[model samples]
Target: MARIVDVNPALVRQRAGAASEFLQVAEERLEFIRAESGESAEAQVAASNAIAAGISAADAICGKALGRRANDGDHRGAVELLDSVKPGGSKLALRLSKLLSDKSQLQYGGYCSAAVARSLAREARKLVEAMNEFGIRS
Candidate 1:
């Protein structure tokens, strides 16, 4: 049988607030990336970081709302947990899955291009907005 645990609204609120802060930073970094000239490598890196941070923020909000930490080394487990909470195979989950899968590649490899970075940033922004709309208190 699955164990039931009490949900802590205060903790959820705190997590939501933290997620909001991370999202703000991610947005600022994305804006910086947008303002850069001619596919700057620095901007690319910033965009990648922003996307990663935005994904983390969204995950935090999902965990808080579900009253459990949605963490797993494979990341697929986190997606499963989130899907359990907000079913229907949401777009946010799909985007997060892609971002999480590409995180290491973006951070360590030289394969990230300006166009890819911009796309990731846009997806991250959408995920953040969806989380806010989900009433995570941010």
Candidate 2:
């Protein structure tokens, strides 16, 4: 079972708000740094923020819909929790899972290419959008 954090409505809004802020940074910085090489630490930062935003978006969705958020070391647990929240939850889970799957490589691996960073940012954006569709309104 996914470890979970019981959340109130205020916490749900807080997570969604955080997700929006992280996404804003990721989107703005990504445009300017997209041309930079993957070795560019700025690009990596932007990508890292994107991944953070996606995670926050997932938390917001689950918190709003299920009154709980996944709190597990394995991010797939987050994905699975999201999967059960709504009809479109699985799609949101897929996006979140993709971001999580790439996290180690993008953030910790030797070099994060601009291409990979861009791809991750795109997925993060989609995940945030899905939060709105799922009624979290990030």
Candidate 3:
């Protein structure tokens, strides 16, 4: 089980709202981000936004359906929680995994290549959209 904390069901919309906003920022960054360029600053920014989008989307989904949000330092726990959600949760979990997998490289120091950056953005968008499809988004 993941280290998750209880969240009020009433805050579902708030979390969903944040997810949507983060997704928007990620989308915008992906568009302007010079993926093939040597400038790592833009890649880091885009990747960071993508990571944030995934985290908030996961929070919204978990809170709305399970009344719990991942609170641990390890993100894999959150992935496990999403995988436990019914129906299409497994799919969402896989996509979220891809985004989270790049967190360390993008956030810290590991060389976030263009392909990795693009992949993170793609996964992040898919997760947010899937969360919306699950009827849990605000």
lDDT of 2 at 51: 93
The model with the greatest TM-score is 2
Model 3 lDDT, residue 77, Cα: 84
What shift in Å separates residue 2 of candidate 3 from its native position after superposition?
2.8
- The 0-to-1 C-alpha lDDT of every candidate, in the order given, reads 0.60, 0.81, 0.77
TM-score of 2: 0.89
Which candidate leads the pack in lDDT? 2
In candidate 3 the C-alpha lDDT for residue 118 amounts to 73
Ordered from best to worst lDDT, the candidate numbers read 2, 3, 1
Tens-place lDDT digits, model 2, residues 1-138: 767889898888888988889988887877777466536766777788899999988889889888898884668779989889776887888899888987888766765767777888898888778777767753
Per-candidate total of colliding backbone pairs? 0, 0, 0
Scanning candidate 1 in windows of ten residues, the lowest lDDT window is 1-10
Q: Give the per-residue lDDT of model 3 (tens digit) for 15-114.
A: 7777778778766766776558665656667778888888888888887778897884668889988888876889888988888887777767855555
Superior candidate under lDDT, 1 versus 3 = 3
Candidate 3 clash figure, as a count: 0
lDDT-superior candidate, 1 or 2 = 2
